[model samples]
Target: MTDQPAVPTDDPTVLTDRDLEVLAEQLGREPRGVVGIAARCVCGRPLVVRTAPRLPDGTPFPTTYYLTHPGAVAAASRLEAQGVMREMTERLGEDEELAAAYRRAHEHYLARRAELGQVEEIDGISAGGMPTRVKCIHVLMGHALAAGSGVNPLGDEALALVRDQWRPDRCSC
Candidate 1:
């Protein structure tokens, strides 16, 4: 809704039954509120899912793009354990340019979620602690993949760090 540049969503891609099954297998449960495959690997497996703002159970789900790939999730969890989030949060405090870019990322995320459906309960709240601090690399990486490049600086950085471990070109699927 704001003046931020639009991030390309899954308007061109369609999710198949196989994709759903794979996602469900990865999650170990039925995928909920999933609208479409936001990002995929080179092997064409679903990496990120574009979910509804509110779940079917009437619960507000602010995580618009969710990372579902097992390998990527593990890498992000490893990064979290290594205190990458803490370092990123500290950097955000000292870096004006990074903070401004992160704010735009939050706005872009909100606009994308609004396109799906806005939930009043989770209004203006983007996942993984955007526009402020780094809470979850998995969420940020999901947004970075969904939004493509440059929309989220921190997310981009996190993705770059994990590139050797999980590259989009190299199929972990």
Candidate 2:
């Protein structure tokens, strides 16, 4: 029996020095440690990353980082919103004709909803319903139209008709 402390099976909560170095390389900056990582998230508020620092018995475990700062979280939210808007604008374009078509289709949907007594309780309509199914077809058509290459409008209309036929009312009739 050798008189030596049992080799700790526990892992470190902080990133290994090598791991930190690699992270720094990927991030293109020097990360001093967890504090540095946390500081990066901090803009106007402290962006603390909560992590599982240890096991049940205080044995060190892998760190799991989470954003805890409101400002950092808000910034992330803004970035996501901007990305979505940019994508929508890029895909849909600012074309007057296309915009008018979408508006007309949307108005039709609204009218259909009102006729079905579904305007107040929007959840009343099922995905299998005529209006909802047609809405989906419109969405697909919009995507196809947005491609802006050699898209066949007749094919889009035909596909929309096929989709409309699959609706519960049409299927039953």
TM-score, each model?
0.92, 0.24
| Pairs with steric clashes in candidate 2 | none
**Candidate 1 error regions (>4 Å):** 1-9
Using lDDT, give the best candidate's number: 1
Q: What is the C-alpha lDDT of each candidate?
A: 0.86, 0.31
Q: Show the colliding residue pairs in model 1.
A: none
RMSD of 1: 5.7
The clash number for model 1 is: 0
Error of 2 at 4 (Å): 87
Clashes of 2: 0
Query: Which candidate number would show the highest TM-score if scored against the true structure?
Result: 1
Off by over 4 Å in 2: 1-91, 121-173
Task: For candidate 2, write residues 1-173 as lDDT tens digits.
Answer: 13221121112343356546544443356532242222221111122222233334544422223333333234334434545324433334545554455444444434423332332334333221122122232233222222221232321343334442321112110
Q: Where does the lowest 10-residue lDDT sum fall in candidate 2? A: 164-173
